[model samples]
Target: MGPEWIVVGIIAVAVLFGAKKIPDIARNVGRAQG
Candidate 1:
């Protein structure tokens, strides 16, 4: 994929996952994995 596609994907992830919720999910997943 191109850089444009990467940007779009990032925007899509931010919208779908959300800025506030993503960090919490990441932290939870990190804790579980670690």
Candidate 2:
């Protein structure tokens, strides 16, 4: 994809999950992968 798509995806994630929730989401993702 393009840089514009990346920006849209980030914004969508922030809107759907909230800015404060991202770190917790990442932590869970990492734990799952481990």
Best prediction by lDDT: 2
How many clashes (backbone atoms < 3 Å, residues ≥3 apart in a chain or on different chains) does model 1 have?
A: 0
The parts of candidate 1 lying over 4 Å away from their true place are 22-34
TM-score of each: 0.53, 0.62
Q: For model 2, how does the per-residue alpha-carbon lDDT over 1-34 read when each residue is reduced to its tens digit?
A: 9899989997999899999999998899899999
**Whole-model lDDT values for every prediction:** 0.84, 0.93
Query: Which candidate ranks first by TM-score, i.e. highest?
Result: 2
Assess candidate 1 and give its lDDT.
0.84
Model 2 residue 9 distance off true place after TM-score fit, in angstroms: 3.8
Which runs of model 2 end up more than 4 angstroms from their true locations? Answer: 1-8
**Residue 2, candidate 1: alpha-carbon lDDT:** 81
Give the per-residue lDDT of model 1 (tens digit) for 1-34.
8899978976887799998887887688799999
User: Measured by TM-score, how close is model 2 to the native structure?
Assistant: 0.62
